[model samples]
Every structure is written in C-alpha cells, then in structure tokens.
Target: MAEVEEVLSHPLNNTDEAIKGTVKLVATPVGTALAYGSLVFMALLPIFYGALRSVRCAKSKNSSDMPETITSRDAARFPLIASCTLFGLYLFFKIFSQEYINLLLSMYFFLLGILALSHTLSPAMNRFFPVNFPNKQYQLLFTQDTGETKEEIVNYEFDTKDMVCLAFSSVVGVWYLLKKHWIANNLFGLAFALNGVELLHLNNVSTGCILLGGLFIYDVFWVFGTNVMVTVAKSFEAPIKLVFPQDLLEHGLEANNFAMLGLGDIVIPGIFIALLLRFDISLKKNTHTYFYTSFFAYIFGLALTIFVMHTFKHAQPALLYLVPACIGFPLLIALVKGEIAEMFRYEESPKEVSGDSNQEKKESEKKEN
Candidate 1:
C-alpha cells in the first residue's frame, strides 16, 4: 500500500502536477462523470450494504439481539448517498448547459439515475421483504451483552450533534452572507493573531529551539494522540464484545506481572461520543447542551488548525484553504456532545446487570408475577 501510494504520489515527479492533471480532467464533463462514478462505487456501495444490514437487524430482532455498535455501513452510507446525489445534480446541470448531450453525459445520467432508483426502491422493498442475518456463534466487535436470558439489544443509533452542527453552520453561513460578512473570516483573523505572536518569537535567533520543541509537543500530544484515540474508539464500536480475561480485568493493570486494557472505559466513552453526535437539537433554550459540547469540539479543531498552518508555513497558501474545516470539525463535535449530554443528567448512577442466571429466578419471578 505504501509503495502504491508513493508511485501514485509522484507518477509524474510531483503531487502538484498530478493534482493539476486531475483537476483538468474534472473540468471536462466526461472526466467529471468518470470521477464521480468511481468515487460512488468506491465509497458508497459498502455503506449501502451496511445500512441495509443495520436496518434489517433492527426490525427483525429484539433490542438484545441487536448489536450495541453502529455498522460501518451506517457510518459511511448516509454521507455517500448525499455526495452521490450532489454529483448527479451537478452532472444534470452540466448536460443542460451543453450544446448536445454527449454519450458520456447520457451514460453518467443513466448510471446515477439507476443508483438513485435502487437506493430508493431497496428501502421500500426492504420494509415488506426484510433481509435477515441470523444469530451466529461468535460475536463481532463493538457489540455488548446485557447477560439477560430475554435481553434484546439494538444497533447503535446516530448521534444528533452532527445534524445540529450542520444546521447551525448553515444558518450562520446564510446570516453572514446576508450581512455581507463571513463568520469564518473573523475566525481566521483570530487564528492569525494568535499565530502571529508565535511567528515573531520564532524569527528571533535564540527562539529557534523553542519553536521546534513546541511543534514536537503539539504534534505528539495534540494531533497524533487525538487521531489515534479517535481511531481506537471507532474500533470498539464493532459487534464483538471487547473484553479482558478475569485475571487481567481484575488485577492486570495494577499488578506487577503484566497489563491489559479496561473494557468499559473505551466502550462507554466511544458510545458517548457516538451518541453525542447522533442527538438532534430543536429550537428551544432547553436544547442548549449541544451548543456547549460543540464548543468543546471546537477547541480540538482550533488545535488542529494551528498545527496545520504552523507545520506547513512554507505552503501558507495551501494551509489558508483549510481554515473552514478547522472551524467546522470542532463545531460539529461540540454540537453532538452537547446533545448527548442533555439526554442524561450530569450525575449518573451506574447501571447494573442482573446477577441471576435464569429467567425464572427470584427477582425475575417477582417482576413477572
């Protein structure tokens, strides 16, 4: 994979040259069709499969029978569907503007239209003729067991934070446009002011080491560390219950012999982050938690922006283009976290699993009777 990436990176000596060629290709209608088609297949097909499977799992079985994790399909499918739809629209507009609808445009429209048809039809058909994947022997990652005989587990649901952020950002953008000023430009200006001081210090002959050392810490603690943690959290969301052996769980971390990771710490937090993003915010003062969490996410985003701009100072032009993402990603995260937090009290009592092995136990009997 590394070798392939290297070969692709400088196929004609530099990445810039490759990107320019790709951009020229994109500028043409035929090239746009080909590119969009390739991207759709590569990104969306698996997502569609996963979403289908997840929805199927939800409808067919009880909550206990469902996994506690979101499938990759669910995570990727919605985004891909939106992207493909946008691409199809762009293609339609291109064809409309052309002198004559070319063969490439015809083929692109047909294929995209077919994909849209299947995408729509599948869900409706699935409602009546639901596909099912039966309970298997082994578990997959990102799943949990409530350890109850009659337990029903459902797949993890989407977080509302992402939706709120999208809506809020859209509103803000529109407002700024109407006012003839962008909120993003203010953010960029603030970022520039903060970085300017660092730059002045770096220019001093004595502060060279200070700048390099700061960069090292920033990359290690902020960028790489955050990225790694986020990835691991994602892995924990699979259908398989992640666990450590009894010995390891009980004593390994504190004991001298060896060490192992804790299960709940990872799973709980990951689920929180997921749930945070899945929450939807309505227009009410009570729904303000999303705002706070979104703000928290923005802090990390700010850190990321600083790292990007600082690291690529030589390529300042390129770094400047990423300012929007720097602001967006953080705001998005904050929105989700706030929503999820609102659903629960700040002080939560720990949930307990029933200790009884059978459904006909004393506690169970008391409830049943």
Candidate 2:
C-alpha cells in the first residue's frame, strides 16, 4: 500500500496541471496513445513481478522477509489518513511558494527513494555479484535496557551485495535530485511500487475489499469533488508517481508532454492482487486462477481508466474503475466455483496463525485428558 502521506494522482489531467505555469507541450494522437500504452505496460510490470516476490517472501523462513500484513482497522483508517495528508499538502502549497515546498519534498523523497530502490534491486543485484566477490555479512543492532529488561529497537542484516545495490541506487537518486529527469523519477517510482506490493500484505480478502472500497471513495471524492488532489499532485515534486512523456515521438528523449499515474493507484490495488496470489497458493491447486483473473481485471480496469480519461479529456479516479474490476472478477469466479466461503476463511497473518495454533493445542490437550 502507498504511504499515507502521499495522495493518489489521477490519470490524465494531473500531468497537464503538473506542467502548468511552464511551457506546455502539445502531443499528437499517436504520441498520446504511445504514452498511455507505456503507462499500462509500466504499471503491469511491478504488479506481476511484485506479486510473485510477495509469495516468496511469505514462504521464506527469514523474519526480515516476512510481509507486513494489514488488518481491518488499518484498512478502514487508510482513507481518512490519506485525505488528511492530501489536504495538508494542498494547504501548504497555498501558503508557501511551490518551489520551496517542492525543494523540501524532493530532498525527503531523495533519501527515501534511495533506500526503497536499493531494497527492490537487492535480489536481482545479488544474482549478478561475481562468484569471486567477497560478500561479507554485516549486522546493525540497537537495544535499550529498562530495569534489567532489554528491548530490541533495531536489528538489520545485510551483505556486500546489498551495499552495492545501495551504491547504484544512490547514483540514480542523485540523478533525480540534480536533474529531476522523468526516467530517474520513474526508476524510484517503480522501486516504491514494487517494494510496497512485495512487503505489504492484506491479511485476508475482506480487509482487501475494505481498503480498495475505501480508497475508491477517497480517490473519487478527491479527484471529482474538489481540486485538492490535483493541486497537491501538481505542486508536489517527488517520485511518488510514475510519469511517461506523451510527446516522445516528436521530441524524442526530451519530451515534456507527460502522463502520470500515482504509485498509490498501483500499490494499493497491487497488494490486493498479491493477497489473491497467496490465497491461490493455500488452495494447493496447480493453477493460479484467482491471481490471473485479478491480474487481467486490473489491466482492464486501468485500460478503461485511460480510455475514459482520453475520451472525456478529464482526470479520472483510477480506483473507481479498478476497484470494481479487481474485486468483482475474482469474486465472480469464486461464486461460480462455489468457493466463496473458503475464500473468505483464508487468513495469513502471524497473529491469526498463532491464535489458531493455541486453540488447536488446547483442543488436543482436552482430548488427551
């Protein structure tokens, strides 16, 4: 899921607003199609790759690899938090100079984006490390003692390959900071989206529904009901959204006509799709029916968002289209297959598992007695 501090960007009009107060570049029909096509492709890559990685992370014995599961409470409160932050930024932009606000935001995201990119690239970078390389392990530990009780504050483990990934990520981060290049921004945005999907787990289908449903209203209200979302999106200078130039054909690499999509749009729906993948794994079936169904539904939803935005020439809440397709498609399948009950019963949180284990142990003890 996206960080609560960042607002979701709408599909089409945010880009126009983003480049406002500057020279606006016009894009032809072919250029516009290409831009939209690239946006779709970019959005698909992270969700597919991240969903697979999330399954691996769930199965991994390493505690560090374990995903952070979202509960019903967290899902319910997400929209309220996001709306507060969105409006807060809108007010900040109104009170201060956009340049100064973005300067601070750019620096903050610079540090955050580097760490996210490094984490996202670590697995792939590890594969490329030469066999002869000395990949020494390192640990960073912090603890505090209170009346003979010690509490662990931070415990992190890494190796030389991880450092190498960080170094490479830092280079990209510097590039983004110095130039604010579209490609550099995209690099960080992709990293953020992939990591969010891989690390954030929805505990069950119901929680996923609550989250997407809440955000559906949030996105719609922000985009259609008021100008707060558009204002903040245009003013905020960060890699929280992925962007593609619409005039790449005419202007080549220097194209300024861009189209944007929020990482929230990708990451929020992405974690839900990932949860479906994990649910499929639990079924012990040879096929990934739910995963693929939700995946294609996401594609259709996003494509519909783009189509509607293009036809109407207006900004659209991506979640409005995405929520129904993502939730409905897999649900329809479950209903048809008579597995709706089983689908809702599946829970993967550590707390839930421990509770179940305790109950089973008590039941067994009573039987033995």
Candidate 3:
C-alpha cells in the first residue's frame, strides 16, 4: 500500500494523469442534486413566461390596452426570451450528459443559474422601495401630480411590501451563495445590493476624484452602457433630430474639456440639474423611477470605487475623493426631479382638500335634516 501510494505521488509522466483522474472521481458526487435541479428550473421558467407573453401579445394584436407587462416594446422581448431559453437548454444538456455531466457542465450551469435568478427578482425590488421618492420641500422644483414643492426626492416613507421582497431576495441569494460554495457570485450579489442602498442614501456629494473615475466606469460601462444600447435599439430607435453646433462634435479643448473627457458626463449632468433648479423653477417634469434609482446607484458605486482604491493605496484619503460626490449629490437630485415624480405617480397622492369637502357635505346634510 505504501509502495503504491509512493508511485502515485511520483513525478512520472503518468502521475499527472493519475492525479486528474483522482480529482474527477472526488468531484463527481460532491455536487448536490438540489443545486442542479434549481438551475434547470430557473433556465426553463423564464423561457416559458417570455414565450407565453409573446403569444398573448400576438393574439391580442394591435390592442394597446393589453400591452405586455414584461416589456413595453416588442423589440426588447426577443433578446430576453432567447437568452433565457438558450441558458435553460444549456443547463438541461449539462444535467443529462454522461461524459460531460460533472466536469464543465456542473461549473458552468451553476454560474448561469445565479444570473437568471437575479434577473427574475430585480424589477420587483426596484418598484416597491423605489430608490427615489419626491420630498415635499422640493416639490415646487418640479410639479408632481399634486403640485407640491420639494428640493430633492425624500425617501421618508418605507414600504413594508418592498422590504419583505428585498428580505426574501436577500435570503435566497445568501442561501444559494452558501449552498453553492461559491464566493464570486455571492460577493457580486452583495455588491449589487449595497449599491442599491447607497443609491437611496446619496445627497450633496462632490466630484473630480478617483471615486468619480470609478463612477464613470460603473455608469458608462456597467450601468448606462447597457441601458443606453438597449434603449436605443428597442424603445427609442427614432431618428436623431439633427442640430448643428448645438450638438456638434469638435476637436481639442473645444471638443473635449475637463467636463467632457473626465468626470464631465456625471458632472455636466449634475451641473444641468443645479441650473434647472436654480433657473427654471417652472420646469415641471418627472422621470421614471429607474432614472433616480440608477442615478444614485452610479453615485454610490463611485464612492465604493474610491474607498476601495484608497484601501489599495492607488488613491488618496477617502474623504478627499468624496468632495466631488458631495457637490454632485444636489445636482443629481435636481436632474432627477421630473423623472421621479412621474415614476412614483405623484399625480396619485390623495388630495388634502377632500377633508374640507367632507365638512361641507356634513353641513349640507345638517341643513337637509
């Protein structure tokens, strides 16, 4: 037995092959049945819903009243449906394959499964807590349906329903993270959630630091890049209204400045927000809830990026970097006012004058009596 063990551990040509065989044998039965089963389900369920919704849309042709809930535009559906369907089929093949089952199949399916599961729950999370809610003090900055005045969107009200949904999603992610014995996906999920919370808490942050640098990447590449592409491709494929000089692309400092090349994308928007609130008191418009949610999300992600960079000595003190964020917070708030009101349906807030109407009705009833 000792001789055989020594032979196996030797640095012979066949030793590498022997070790690989051993590793595979050890890994085969390690994966739990439940993990594979969930992967199969997640992959299939989205495809099913997407297909069914598409069919329903087809059957109800030209019926604007029965619009698709999953997506407003028809072009958006194909990619989403196709991706989920393909992912599901991939998992199924992995689960059933005899030779490839436990090797490449097991590892790849697990990763795909987490991505699908996250997508399945993200929309409901955005809706309930609504990362953005218009505050009364700043309501005048933009006109909500109620015509209230506010400086920035206030999130004083907490939705228990949303809290419950978030809690459930957290629990699900945590459970999967632990059961799957994976660190990367777990960390990514946690980071995503933290970004959501940071978005909710942003106010009066500045710009022009590593954090801002981080935010540019987070927004332009991670968040805005995908969203802009999808928006243009699907919903707003309309022709660009040509306006020269106003929208001209120049070269040099004329073409690119501190605002254009670096933090300007975020800073410029922030400045516009500040100007809108300062100059255009009559600018009464709102954006979608997603606009605000994602707005702060990018801001917070920038903060995190700065903090992490500082930790590695790639940047200066965290506070110094945050000056830009501190300054930009108000600007972002102003920029998002119109969108926020439309999103929360500020037009739907219960009327305060109704109590006076009720009192008048009571007096009329007394006279009748």
Question: In terms of lDDT, which candidate is strongest?
Answer: 2
- Candidate 1 residue-wise lDDT, 1-369, digit = tens: 000000001011123443222321112334323322332232222222332233333233322223233233333342344334434433554456442433343344333333222332333343443246332233223535654454434333322332333344444334433342322222222222211211111111112222222322332332233332222222221111111122222343331111111121112112222222223222244443433343344234333433443344211111122223323443455466563334432221111112222333556778987
Residue-wise C-alpha lDDT for candidate 3, range 134-224, written one tens digit per residue? 4222111322455235232332223344345445655554544345322233333233322222121111122122223343333333222
What lDDT does each candidate get?
0.28, 0.84, 0.29
**Candidate 2 local Cα displacement, residue 270, angstroms:** 0.3
- The per-residue C-alpha lDDT of model 1 at residue 307 equals 41
Off by over 4 Å in 3: 1-283, 286-319, 329-369
Looking at candidate 2, the ten consecutive residues that score lowest on lDDT are 4-13
Candidate 1 runs further than 4 Å off = 1-288, 295-345, 352-362, 366-369
TM-score of each: 0.22, 0.90, 0.21
CA RMSD of each candidate after superposition: 23.2, 5.2, 24.0
What 10-residue stretch in candidate 1 is worst by lDDT? 1-10
Which of the two, 1 or 3, has more lDDT?
3
Relative to the true structure, candidate 1 reaches a TM of: 0.22
| TM-score of model 3 vs. true structure | 0.21
lDDT-based ranking: 2, 3, 1
